[model samples]
Target chain A: MQVRCPHCASVFPSDRAGTQFCPRCGAQIHVPEEGQVVEAGLPPFAPGAPPEPSGAEGPGPGEGPTPALPPGVREPTPWERRRELGLFKAVVETWKASVLSPRRFWPSVRPEAPWTEALLYGWLIGAVTSIASIPLRVWQQRRSVDELREAAERLEELPARLRDILRPIVESAGAGTTGDVVAQAILGALLWPVGFIILAAVLHLCCLLVGASRGGFGATARAVGYAWGPMVILYLPFIGWLGWVYAAVLAAWGVKELHETTWERAVGAVVIPFVVVCCFACCLGMAGVGAAFSSLRASP
Target chain B: MHLHLPPRNRTFGFVDALGVTGAVGLAIARWVPVARIVPFWGCVLREQTGWPCLGCGLTRAADRFAHGDFIGALQANPLGAVAAAFFALCVVASALHLAFGVPLPEVRLSPREARGARWALVVAVVLNYAFVVVQTRFPHLLA
Candidate 1:
């Protein structure tokens, strides 16, 4: 008997009449007996014809306005369809959805689209943010330099160790010219693609370690690329770090939706690597302290 | 495992994008004095805590590897050397795949194999960290 999955609309033949998993997407479904199929509003299966998605019919009654995708199916983002909608509109729409409504947006974003398209979207955001924020960053740097100088001058009253610690920061902050800051901004912006790829590789490795990378590296890469949407407003000084936090949140959501995994696994995949790095650093720091103490004692 | 040949007209994929970006980053690192222009303060972990971080010599390793000093890169950071070599491999693989339509071989591991690989990775990272610590702190032992 032919059974049509109400979720993804994929039709397949089932010999038995019980619960089984969908062949295409691995989703669980119930197989009804002959003439027992009673899914409302779902189209009947026609052999040799491509399965039509219920999303084409729009949301049913009592459903929310957001066109939520069914499990195991995804549509292309506005950015991926830029040829059809003009580039500017696509970029805006994609950015809006990614930053404002990631839960709805990420599930709908087709993970299998060419990764370069996603990287291009991220690069565009990074480049624009860097270019637009150059003056602001330069102004901030100048202000910080003055503040550091003031703090450095008052450091003599503090403990000797504290003074020693802050002196390098003050010196480093005061040393850079505005031209260097501008150059740094430009170069940092240009390196976004490489940085995103490297980040995705690390995150994907973490995902694999945590058993959350069911959708493969392409999906992870796409998620990381689109997660940069929040960084569009990284120019805002006080709220800039908040935007970064939101970007990380969106990345977690992206992994969850793209990989069709539980929230726990997704969050673990993102957080575990950083935690490991921190712990490793702490251990190394302790070892270094030990070595320093031993060397000091030996010298005497 | 079975081999899956990609379609003739494949779109730009993860490896391809990674290859392009990694190659560009390496090229810039090779030619440009990025470290000098950026005014990077040395690592805070090393400076304040009297310890070398896990990524202590990664920059020097990348710099050395960019100039074809493989042994020097390994001496600096074994993992960094491995990563540099992987990036170089990606460049070559991406070129062949993009230009000649040659598909990269896909390896699929079973659940048991994947578990083993994960453990192996953890062991490798720990071993590499030990190497980094000894090389940085007790150089005489290595010598």
Candidate 2:
């Protein structure tokens, strides 16, 4: 159930329904059941990204071997070339990974620590730190809310645009009464913190289901979308095109699985559908208009 | 712009656990004061000095903030005000969402705007710290 990634020092849930690699960071996770696949090796730093150069620590370079510079001058050997390339490649990839791109790092659910551990370990690791930091947290929370509040006021046509953006995502969530959809969204907006926490918790559970659990939820910001439903509040201030995007992603992820889980867990099941319908509708709508316009032009 | 809420709302699994954790924390803070956690009598390094340490009143400050005594909370720790306000917002907003499917459509800030907001908060906290230092050094400044 618990597997550690040698490269990243990460603990993951490896007891998958089937074989799975490290889902978070691409690493060769040893899955006991996967006897033959073990040799498949770690998903390279990236597919087709190329390995390190020869003569360096990583995979050798692409060159067969360094050729003689001139009749007298000597050249680096293949092993040397490979080593240099590998090291260079590794450093570059690490830097790229470290300096996050919104596209790569910021997803719908960022994931936080395992709820059980984050809270408990927090209690032990000097509760004062938690207690003392309350003010800072408060400051941050209010700052976020205040921003949302103003944005809501300034954007007079937010509803219309939101509808356009939200429609497709909503449709995907599943069918819902207008009131129900609105209420679910509003609920998501209001109790986002709790929603955020619960969202992370549920996501963690899902990761376990998939057998590629992440270690700690990590920082709150990192786990931002892990609890997408409540993050609506977080977007309140932005109330812009980007804010709408966050809302759509959260709703879509939350609702996508609602129908399946609704039967087993009636209440959460309801939310899942609601989120799905809303997010799906928004995404589809956005895509649909582009398609319609393009098709119109083509017909002419 | 238009905001939408799902007509129906449902609770998730983390609710019960969060509730229990929060309740237990609140109970401990209320019933057992932090100072009591220390021994009543012992030879201590700070025994010779009468002044409180920088972090002395923080626990009480948190307790007061949690209890909703905003003024008392601020007096205990300036950061207490911000924390109290935020915590109240969180609790209120969450309760509203639970009772009614729609969350209270409140305000928010994007990262861009927060640049200015961050400064404002910094100034407030700094001023609060100044007040604390002044009061501690010159008790008469309290008047």
Candidate 3:
């Protein structure tokens, strides 16, 4: 039977009798989606395109479990539809746009975009999180030794793991401030990966909400990893560069193969070399242009 | 998030820049005997009573791991050693995908699973922080 939502006036078919709120208008009437206890959210562009009316009308080709939208939702730009499922996200697409191509750090600051916010926020959050954990830690510390042990035991493997992280800090705290800073640094590195993901995601979602950009956790991680992940590791001895190089090259290839990439592995091969060459050509062109412009003089 | 990727020099952006920096930083630190760097940092950490820490040898660990010495990497820091292994796997899988027309490596989670995983990770971290604090204050019982 077709249920008409009194609010937004959208009429979609319901498999059962009773209905609830009109999703279109936020009105809570007595209508629901057939027998569905929970239903999917309405589509983004679904204002006009209602679901198939009741049974008398007919079943639509892409009805019921709505047909998947073409992988790329952008306008009429035609691209091949991969025969296999992608590896999680269109990682290759994201990689190409964000990591490989360079300009992809949208919504977030650009390389040249002032570092004011990021640096300030990073430091502030780092310090705050560090200080905040102190009391929480202290309260737990107050518990009986046996109780704490039991809790730690119950925790499986995480206590020792977490203790290893705080050892230097705790040991140093017996002394003074220098140790505190070191403690913070150690803590910062340990926590940054997880915290950064959340921060980046929030920033990205805000961007999307405002029609500013599609930045998200994945993109932010890639960007931060690209810019700072290496720099942080740069403090290491001789082999530090090796890690950075490895990460860099891997990131590059990943970006090149992001789009139309399958979860299987071979598609990346086809994409990388082509991208590498294309990348090389673009570099030469940029250099050539730079040289030409730098030596500019009137034809006279 | 909507990210605006400005133009970048592939030859010298993060990957390239970090490589050069790491090589130079390592060389300089090694040669300079700088009193304010990693080893020094380690010494200073030692001076402290050591509340406990996870990444004690991470920098060195990453250094060693990067050089293809998995054992050396572990010596520096086991966690970093693990991370290095994951990175290597990612590289091999990605490289193969790039070199041939193979599909990409299996992504760990679908969008739904991923969303769920993220929140779980956050909870784990907070709990970890609490665990560390408690352990530092009372080590014997757990130890």
Candidate 4:
């Protein structure tokens, strides 16, 4: 019996049962049961071309044929798709996308990317910000020194002993500030990983207490790491504070998405730790004040 | 290619590196006699208002502490030695974590504990800053 290849429109003798490739064109052909006539005159079906609409009913205007796909293929996830462009590009693109649309972007990031990559991403961003701010820091420091000098000059009317004491403090201003830029950059980069760990632990604890910790610690860490995306703008003058606020918002969004929890829970997870830390700080301040008062009372 | 280290291990590595770098920096600062040549950006608050900030002299103090000058470190800034100790501890903890997969214990403070810790830090900073201010402003009082 003869068969026609639907894909290449090649005609060949059908010697095998079930499915077979056309001998002339290599198009897959399905052999029929006995007594079926082969349609040998149909046009060849291009491998990647979309299937034509049924006879007498073509696709209407604005309706395009769907692209053909090989079997067993699936669309890439957002992270995988972004990563396909290369690491640097992926980092830049992801950071941009995250800053612009954190609500949408963060939810799309699954916990599949290694947490270390996220930590590195956060650290690099922090380091860039620190390096960029070196000039500003230097300017601020110089201004401070000038102000100190003026203050010391004003103290010239005080007792000679007082002047002697202030002299060393004022004079020491000129020492050991040269390599500060490198120090700041290294410290900034190094602090990020530690910060992330602390943040993750606090947030995870809060989530657990609040009964919203559906996701594991890994997911929470990933969320916090990606939340540092907004820190890319930390070098921007005046508006730099906004970057931190945006980062906080993004972190909440990330927690919500990653943990599949309520918005309140996510926000609480982030905010509660901060509140606790603040409370602790306040208590310490009060105790310091009380102690100072006690010492003053004890003094003549 | 990405590193095969787990996230926790990577974090440990970063913290450990930071601690080492800080220790090394302190060590160098102790040995180097280039203090007069290097510009010290002293405390801006003190420069502007004649009052020392909480962190004033911290770098110098840390350097002194790293060099085993405990008295000098205390006089420079009491908290400096504490900060140096923290960095040292971080280094040790990170090493243990990396080698044994043992993680830092999670802090789960009760409300009372949180309040106490916060108050303690606040008091420490305030008292320290007060000491600095008095020591700088009234050098005769100490005598």
Top model number, lDDT = 1
lDDT of 1 at A51: 18
For every candidate, the chain B TM-score is: 0.87, 0.62, 0.45, 0.66
All models, DockQ values?
0.20, 0.01, 0.02, 0.03
Q: Which tens-of-lDDT digit does each residue in A1-300 have in candidate 3?
A: 666664455776666654245556554434443543333322212244221111111111222322332211121000111124243233233334333443222211222222222333334434444565554434433443445445544544434444443344344333334445456556875666445443333333322222212112233233333333223233344554554454444433322222111222212332334455465455445544443343343212
Give candidate 3 misplaced runs (Cα > 4 Å): A1-300, B1-40, B43-46, B108-143
Q: Which of the two, 1 or 3, has more DockQ? A: 1
Model 1's TM-score against the true structure = 0.66
lDDT accuracy of residue A257 in candidate 1: 81
**Model 4 error, position A146 (Å):** 2.3
TM-score of each: 0.66, 0.32, 0.27, 0.47
- Writing each residue's lDDT as its tens digit, candidate 1 over A111-156 gives 5556677889999999999988899989998898888888888978
Off by over 4 Å in 4: A1-83, A152-176, A235-237, A277-300, B1-143
Error of 3 at A143 (Å): 56
Off by over 4 Å in 2: A1-300, B1-25, B38-56, B65-70, B106-108
Strongest candidate by TM-score:
1
Q: Is candidate 1 or candidate 4 better by lDDT?
A: 1
Badly placed stretches (over 4 Å) of model 1 are A1-73, A81-89, A148-172, A175-191, A272-300, B2-11, B18-64, B75-77, B99-101, B130-143
**Which of the two candidates, 2 or 3, achieves a greater lDDT against the reference?**
2
lDDT of 4 at B98: 67
> How much is A25 displaced in model 4, in angstroms?
45
